[model samples]
Target: MPVPDAPVTGAHRETPEPPGGDRPSRLDPAIAARLRRTPDGLVAAVVRQHDSGEVLMVAWMDDEALHRTLTTGRATYWSRSRREYWVKGATSGHHQYVRSVALDCDGDAVLVSVDQVGAACHTGHRTCFFTELPVSSGEVAS
Candidate 1:
């Protein structure tokens, strides 16, 4: 089955226009080629819960992770700290089933809508970002 939210041919895949009418080109062949040529072409991902507006996770994507995510319709990420591939919710049963994937104007980041199961954090929290640092206070607290 085709992955949900995967871009279909003829669909409007244009990147959003920036302020002052400055808009980068969408993920065309040329841009895709350039991305492939980069040493770390993969970008950031924003994983949101499909039913709720809750953000389940934010992860980084490498080329392999992107490919796997597109092919499998599941969230896949490159673990920079671990130096390996991480299929979200794979081990913990907190899988994120992709609903859609969008690229930013510069193609440097991605937003993913997904059907999240269980918790998105290994720490048993619902989200990977469990702690919030007070911006004004500059204090780190969970």
Candidate 2:
């Protein structure tokens, strides 16, 4: 599928209120049609710092979570372990103010650009990817 350069919500029509209890999705049909969900019905969300291009964290998002993020301009994710929806910064003061959101060419992942404040990791790291893996080359790849 040839994905548009525009964000998924760029031309989305306002739908009824988001999904209620146990409801699967309230995502716009157009957007939903473009997604390629996992067996558990989710897409990977890669969050990054807008200005610095620093990857902050990775999370999952179901259709409803995506809808809430798009509509609210906050980073909302489906907590796989917790099995619930959580908006970033809701509990922690570390907030991700959304700058933009775009689906990958494969429709299986999304890139969320945001103005991140405070720690973006559960361990209080600025980013979730703190530990660097040992590389055989030990040199930056050009």
Q: Top TM-score: which candidate number?
A: 2
Q: Model 1 lDDT vs. the true structure? A: 0.64
Write model 1 residue lDDT over 47-131, tens digit each, in one string: 8887787887788876556766877898877655544567776556667889888777776677888988777766677787778
lDDT by residue (tens digit), candidate 2, 48-108: 9999999999999888889989999998887655556778887667788999999999999
- The lDDT per prediction is 0.64, 0.80
Clash count, candidate 2: 0
Off by over 4 Å in 1: 1-31, 34-39, 135-142
Among the numbered candidates, top lDDT falls to 2
Instruction: State every prediction's TM-score relative to the real structure.
Output: 0.65, 0.80
